[model samples]
Target: MTFSLRRMLYEDRYKLILAACQDIRRHREEVAKTVIASQLLDALDVDVPSDALLSHIVAESLLRRIDRNLLSGRNLYLQVEKRPQIDLFTLLQRAIPAVPQGYALANQYLVHAMRQSSTPTLLEIGIGKGLQVVALLRALARDPGKIERIRVIALDPNRTALTEGVAAIDEVRAELPFDIEIYPLVKLIEVCEDADYAHFEALAEGSLSINAAYTLHHTTGPDSDARTRLLRRLRALKPRVFTLVEPSSDHDTEHLTRRMHHCWQHFATVFDLVDRSDASPDEKFAIKEGFFGREVRDILGTSDAFRCERHETLESWLLRLKKSGFVPYPEIELDVDLPEYCRSSVSSGLVRLSYRSVPIIAVFAFAGEAG
Candidate 1:
């Protein structure tokens, strides 16, 4: 059998690095011991070492920037090599260096919201491998007496993701004495109309706590009424609390140049932080390229359906929410006690953080009027 290699575009370079990072992070020891193939090195546009460290390959790739095609995701490592592909959800878990800190922040809000409920019901959108579920359950585990049982409605388009997420939250059942039940809804919010949300809203059983982490931006255009319509849809759920987590950037412009600049400025700050993180060079590359890098492509590459990654700050999100009948929940700091992983990821940097230094992700808690 003969196989032909796919030609990679310059825009695919960062994506290639993302693939390389995911692969190396998954097989660190193997990469450290062997002389990786010339084909691999050429594929990544990096030099080959006699005994190569994946970290070294990642560092070398970062030295150069892609010149053409701007940003594209194509012929990804798994696609080219036919390797056991990394699940985007699981890879995101491993690739995002600061996600734990972000998750911890969201978990605190989950605890606060659930503590107020008679029977806590959490509706998490973008249930990617159940990362948010883990955070919510962990927070509940910390305060077992707050609620007797928690019902989670996890929504995503992928059934595999539902399976993975259900399995993850199921573990919390063993840790907490309270009954934990997870209902996975396989649907994408992008296509859903106001009435479509009724299905999940019906399952709320009572006052609901809705959590949409990094998922709302994809639901509609930044300036479109669709944004408000979407907000109204969630508001109609009569949520007791809504936990929102989004990137702290405004990449919603129509101008290609403006989008490109915002994309650069945003990821530049992020990549700089990744460079400073105590994570190994390979892990840093993966976080930057595999995880955040894909975001850069999403913002710059296309504006087609669901390819929309329109990010807006907390202030911007609030503007829409307030217009749509959602009001602020009682303000709670809920400062995350950043674990060593987070501390290390943000550590070893000498740059004094000024206006340029900002949190990559922000968490907000809000609520809408009851029906």
Candidate 2:
């Protein structure tokens, strides 16, 4: 067979599987859905090393099928209260290095934003378990003379996350030479009102900084303007610097085929990194199934209204930040080590972390229009 013909055949198979999924979504013929499910399961039996992406798609489709039938006619994403899968999630994140690298890079600007102040306050959006905030506090503590006291206004929709994140931050407080105060807010960015911004502004004493790592994309709205509106509200708070880190994919799209393609391309790099990690096989399986697999399920399986993992491209984020009256805040390059296969680049005042040649995560800093 000619190479072109083989490529064409390969794409056709993927399209056929996707069409099967759409048919299941639209016309729920149990027999047809079962056949498609069986085909996907059989496809997973193939062990070609280069077919990892294809294998993951098949596996994800199977999970979505199970979710549809097993959830009593309700989408699982809507019904279940998601708890933090911390250990495996951290393992997967550490293995990839993109998340940690983004955290480190964002911390650089976050610390820089507060270096000159005697009293620094941070308004961290979606401060999940305070991982990044704890890291940022530690970085700030390195120069105890510059900063005497710090306050953190942590916001997250997950009550459990907010509670535990506050505890984690407090644990580090006793060890630091500076005084630490934390105010935890259990709220979503979409629903935060003017009172919330006023409260945040009132909390500031000297310098204020904002950091949203792997957050903000979760802000779902009735329309696309939800994120922009939230950013505008945040801009009004007038933090010295705002740093954001988000996945470099467009899974927020309503089109399933496009979402599937983007998810496959983006997660393939992530899963490949997990596969290469020195982690135990069971650990990797847990990370892939428990952490990343759930993300895949939410993206591909749930209804548009119920879906929460709304990721977008770096370009789209830049446009939204500009629309909300933000200008790029530059950072000094750090001398941090990365995995041999990973690469980092700084361009247009944005730092992009990539696996092989595909960009996976983007980190950038911006200031409000006045600043």
lDDT of 2 by residue, 159-230 (tens): 998998999998898678788888899998779888888888888864788889888888888798888988
As for candidate 2, its clashing pairs are none
Off by over 4 Å in 1: 1-98, 193-196, 221-223, 303-306, 338-356
Model 1 C-alpha lDDT per residue in residues 175-235, reported as the tens digit of each score? 8757777777788876776565776677677658888877788776444677777778888
| Regions of model 2 farther than 4 Å from truth | 1-35, 42-84
TM-score, per-candidate, Cα-based: 0.69, 0.84
Q: Could you say which candidate leads in lDDT?
A: 2
lDDT at 15, model 2: 57
Q: Best-fitting candidate, measured by TM-score?
A: 2
Query: Can you give the lDDT of residue 63 in candidate 2?
Result: 45
